[model samples]
Target: MSSDADRDGDARPGPGRAQRDHWERTYGAHPGMYGDEPSAPAVRAAEVFLALGARNVLELGAGHGRDALFFARSGLTVTAADFSPAGLDQLGARATADGLSDRVTTAVVDVRDPLPFADASVDAVFAHMLLCMALSTEEIHSLVAEVRRVLRPGGTFVYTVRHTGDAHYGAGTGHGDDIWEHGGFAVHFFSRALVDALVEGWTLDEVIAFEEGDLPRRLWRVTQTRR
Candidate 1:
């Protein structure tokens, strides 16, 4: 989550339209609420992907497409996935207007479910603060497995998550050990132990403290690779 508020602009909408109907209404009401610039984590992660020679990137919870547009502008083809129809539509329109439509595709997805892409089809997976949503430990692990399955050998998965040390960690209603519900959204904070567990069966490249937004969301910028 981009500083517990946004990831690449803190996309607050989540899950599918069924149970989490709030997200649909939220996106519909506040279309393009986020700024145009991608988050700082996404900016840095794009450099890492390019260094790894990644060509195709699948971005989950793409929100308003700030990071997706940045990746496309940097010459990487991006599949921008989000659950909100309004968010996806805004992203599509922006991509077309920016002349990056050929380099970008938008999809509505429930991250808790199976990813729609074919196995070993992508060069990298970029999930900016998408992991901190209402996902449980098992579901988070499963999502990682899906990322691993969808990436070609040597592909990278670059993502960000709010760290437990942030001021907001214990402020919200407890959903789990490190999960909190506040402002009508649930966020799962991460510790190093959880990070290690999340990167199992993969090569952990780095985990750094990343601060963002005015409140300064303390977060972990995690980079891993499929063996």
Candidate 2:
């Protein structure tokens, strides 16, 4: 679920601006950069949701709605949320083309801002590789709390993050924390300790290691259920 990054020869800290702008420009510049197919982690998540009888899914950072459409087609109503307006538009276009507009909803939501979903409204929350994006440990924990708040009791929060075991983990510009920036993108690598700390108030179901892409982007697929 992790996105590609340049780790070989990246420079010092990128200048500060809205992270949303970076993502918007990234999507706008390269259409279908991540492609239309649902990621492997997403496919596994859909299976877990169906097993849990989750009828509605809230997907954070649902770029291009790939995973959202997969969930919707699997009979779960999906709300595909992302900060990039253009990304949402692409997702809407695809949903329309696939005649899934009825089952899928799109929203422009910045995860750094408060989530717009009502409390205890969704049966499941899924965010693939979104938790690793340029967020501090505090911010990541806060976001998880919000995810928990928006889930019904026993609803699952499924997410993935770049693992500290990744080959790219220590190669980029170091933040002296778990985070590192390369090619203007920041990724907060997750350790078992950090994940253990973040899963407070939820039951940790799994933390499986996996890889994606030719860079062999190593990741941890962590799952938690609201208590």
User: Which is the leading candidate under TM-score?
Assistant: 2
| Per-candidate clash tally | 5, 0
Overall lDDT per candidate, in order of appearance = 0.83, 0.84
Score every model by TM-score.
0.89, 0.90
The C-alpha stretches of model 2 lying farther than 4 A from their native spots are 1-18
lDDT of 2 by residue, 1-227 (tens): 12113223323243213455788899899776788789999999999999999999999999888899999889999999987778888899989999999999998776755687789999999999899987777778889999999999999989999988988788878775677877767788899899999888999999999999998999999999999
**Lowest summed-lDDT stretch of 10 residues in model 2?**
1-10
Check candidate 1 and list the clashing pairs. Answer: 2-6, 2-7, 3-217, 6-10, 7-10
Candidate 1 colliding pairs, count: 5
- Angstrom error of the Cα, residue 63, model 1: value is 0.5
